[model samples]
Target: MMHLIRLELKKGGFTSYLWGSLLAYAIIACFIMVLYFTGNNLGAEGFQNYEDALNAINTFVLATFIIYASVLLSKLIINEFKDKTIHLLFAYPINRKKLILAKLSIVFFWTFVNVVLANLLIDVLFITINQIFGYVSGTLTITLLVHHAIYVLLQAFGAAGMSLLSLVLGLRKKSAAFTVATSIFIVMIVCSSNGNFNLASIIAVPLSLAVLGILITYLSFRNIDRVDVD
Candidate 1:
């Protein structure tokens, strides 16, 4: 399984995705800082303080990468189905279920790992910058940082899993555009916020959605060999 995953990653040429993720991080970092320094002109309803900024940043990253996962899924699966290249893959001397699982595992774990790592680096970077500038009127302590770390990890897991939910909509039409659009719609509902009331902050929403995603992933490959390439 690990070998197959490695082969897929090698052929997927995902180095560019990593570069794109970095660019996203830069944009998010700049966004929060602008909020801090801009003095309430740009609508900081949910981002009232420095601490709330963490949640806002995590939400942005989560939304960004869930959609990221969708685009990759489009390329790795939906596009192949559309172009009839999946028939070639099905011709290989491999278990169809394993091939599908390998592709999915890459997207899931990649989204998971990137979200966690990006939040960690950005959180620390934000703290360091906050120390230098003292923009928001709050003091950071070790206890709060520990708690935030746990929250971020849980959020990352949920985002990673819930990302697969896009497959439910994407595979139905074998349309890449539909896949990506569905992801955006999912992000809007889960991450939407008004005056600090975020759907994801409810805990049950993302947790339940994550569970649903796991079910969707299972259903996706449960009858793999029975699925027709034509």
Candidate 2:
């Protein structure tokens, strides 16, 4: 399994994706900082404060990750099938289910890690800037920092799960367009619900997404053999 995952990593150009993730994080962080500084002028009430700014950043970042993950899954999974490379994969002396699982695992792990790291980096930068420049409101106490860390990690998990769910939908239809479109729709819904920035949403949304991802993954695994790789 480890060998297969490594092979996929090489074949899938994981390094490029890593670099892309870093670039995306930089862009998001910059955008958040801009909004933080000019939020009042932009008519964004409550965005000048640390908590609200963090919430807004989290919501946008998670949504971006959802789309990003969906694109990765499409390239790694759906494109393999569409291009008939999956036929080559199945020719190996490995269990078909395990092969698919390995691919999905790569998608999930990288997506989760990318989102978590990005969120953490943004949090650190935001707090540091606030401490130095005092642009944003609210104090970043130890407890609040810890809570933000936990919440962001949870949101990362949720984003990864939702991406996988979108993958399952796209794979079922063997349509990259469908997968990307569904991902966009899902992000829209998630962003709408996330605008409130409530404690309950932080818990409820991620948990619900995780559960849905588990179900979809199980279903995808069970039906792997039925998928027409040719």
Candidate 3:
């Protein structure tokens, strides 16, 4: 599996995607600053405590990367199927399930790691900026920091698993547009918030989505060896 993933990374030229992720991080940070500050202007949606800020940032980061995961799926899997390149891979003596799993693993781990890292960097940047401007209320204690770490871990794992579900529709349609669009819809279901009604805040929501995603991946792998790449 590791060898297959390394080959995918080398042949796939994932360096460009890494650069794109960096750019996404910078853009997310800028938006966080702008929104939080502007929100403080009217004292409306601005964060009232450290937990509130972390929660908002974590959700935003996960949502953005979940959409980004679809792009990876589009490039790695759907595009190959669409262009008939996947036939060459399936022709090899490799197990089709493992090959596809390698690709999906790339998407899963990429989204997971980036969400955790983005939160760390963005959290520090926002807190520093807030310290200078004194817009947000409350301070970050050891208790809150510990809780944030735990929260980020669960959210990262959940986000990683749920991202696989995006491939379900994309695989059926075999369209990159459909893949990305499905991810956007998933983000809406899990991440979007209205006033105090946040679906993501409910523990069961993300967990159920994650479990469903895993089931989807497992089911797809079952027939992958016999399934032709038509």
lDDT by residue (167-211, candidate 2, tens digit) is: 878877888898899889887776765445543255677668867
Per-residue lDDT tens digits for candidate 1, residues 1-230, read: 88889988898898998898899888888877777666445554424566687887888889889999999999888898889898998999989889888999999898999889888888888778778777656777788788888888888888888988888788889899999999999999989888777888776787789889989889877988986765
lDDT of 3: 0.88
Q: How does candidate 1 score on lDDT? A: 0.84
Clash totals, every prediction = 0, 0, 0
Which model scores highest in TM-score? 3
The whole-model lDDT of each prediction reads: 0.84, 0.79, 0.88
Checking candidate 3 for backbone clashes, the offending pairs are none
Tell me the tens digit of each residue's lDDT in model 3 across 1-230.
Answer: 99999999998899999999899899999988888888888666777777888788888898999999999989999999889999999989999989989998999899899999999999999989988988888867999999889888888888888988988889888899999999999999889888755777666777778889989879976898877668
- Each model's TM-score? 0.94, 0.90, 0.95
Residue 66 error, candidate 3, Å = 0.4
| Winner by lDDT | 3
